[model samples]
Target chain A: MAEQKQVARPLSPHLQIYKPMLTMMMSITHRITGVALYGGTLLVVWWLAAAAHSDAYFAVVQGFFGHWFGKLILFGFTWALVHHALGGIRHFIWDMGRGFKLPTVEWMVRANVIGSILITVLLWLIAYGVKS
Target chain B: MNEMSNASNMKTPLKRVRGFGASKTGTEHFWQQRATAVANLPLMAVLVWFLIAHFGATRAEVIASLQNPIIALLLIMALASACWHMRLGLQVVIEDYLHSHLAKFAALALNIAIATSFFAIAAYSILKMSFAP
Candidate 1:
């Protein structure tokens, strides 16, 4: 049998060590919104499946989406989807080896944040506007 | 003679490390992610448009709109690509944060199963609507 030795080691610096910056914040939001999109996609599946099942089932699903809480969730889902998509574009730009400069990265992060919210609101407004 | 014998007995470092080099699939994964991201750009726009058009529409109208061949095709493509992209993205997240081996494996498997089944269900529904009327 071999004996093991104990050693003291320093741990990697974590969230407490650093101030939050726009890029860092956006990166975290990107992961969160990605996960949220998974749930949102499931809702999309539910809606499609309900429609295929029957009109009654479809109406139930529609009614659920029409309710206040459901609308809130849908709103959140829309934001998540758009945010994640923009985050992905940012990632793609990085993959292409562009936008690595601090200013460019920060600008991209800000754009994603603003663009997602604006687009979501615009989409809902359009929906309501066309509806009425 | 001694040098020849040493050379024959010793393993070249490259030979020892060859199989362990890169996973060799990192590039493929990166490309797949980027490709799907690009595809999703247009597809997502189509999805938003379709949803907006169907908003407040009656059941019959909704079905009729989905029955459009172009709409059905685009919807399925968007959903399938989204599932693929989601699975790849989540897999990276799991690999990064899930330190437990068993937990990581379980999460990866669950991710695949969920994405696959969701895509299947959505695709089936779209196909049903397109053809069953």
Candidate 2:
């Protein structure tokens, strides 16, 4: 009868050991922005709940959202939402078993990044335009 | 005696039903995630349009806009789908990173609870606004 020997194994290469590629960077950001959307959804719930409560409550919520810090947070939320949504679309395409080629993958990654920023900026521009 | 003899070699009905060993819900989870992802694409567009249209509007104005049957219904649908989708996505991330069994279980439970609570609140608020007198 042969006895099996157990030995310790080294950990897999992590962030410090591996060079970050665009795809890898975008993958991590996709996750991060996904998490950000959770917080943003909570804010949306709060705003809705306030509106349901009363005009005064809604006004308070609006006032908070109108503040500089509030606007900053909202901006981040908007960007995260757009970025994550675009990233989801990219993943969906991959799931369809296409876009595996290097060039195509790189193009998708770039699109996720740039498309998110452009859409966020455009939405915000429309928002400001509507506001005033 | 024959039944007892057969039991030793036979697979249980429950095992047969599961097809996949423990936690036989894997396919359902994956399918639901993808379904919600597809649903969110257009729903999110609607949500963005609503936000852009209503930006800087007064409380009454916002409420009135939301009070529209189509707008409120779509908003609720989007909120439910997005929150459910977000919870599942976060669950995958937490499961991958959290090594401890206890911590992973707690995190999964927390993810579902938070998502459900947020969905409930948002849905309730939307309904309230839509049906306001």
For every model in order, the TM-score on chain A comes to 0.91, 0.90
**Model 2 Cα lDDT, one tens digit per residue, A1-132:** 257676688889879898889999999999999988999999989988988898888889889989999999999999999998899999999999999999999999998899999999998998998888
Say which candidate scores most in DockQ: 1
Superposed Cα deviation of residue A103, candidate 1 (Å): 2.0
lDDT of 2: 0.89
Instruction: Count the clashes in each prediction.
Output: 0, 0
What's the TM-score, to 2 decimals, of chain B in model 1? 0.82
The digit string of per-residue lDDT tens for model 2 on B1-133 reads 4342464567665556678546667478788999999999999889878877866667788778987899999999999999999999999899889989899999999999999999999999989888888
Q: Estimate each model's TM-score.
A: 0.88, 0.88
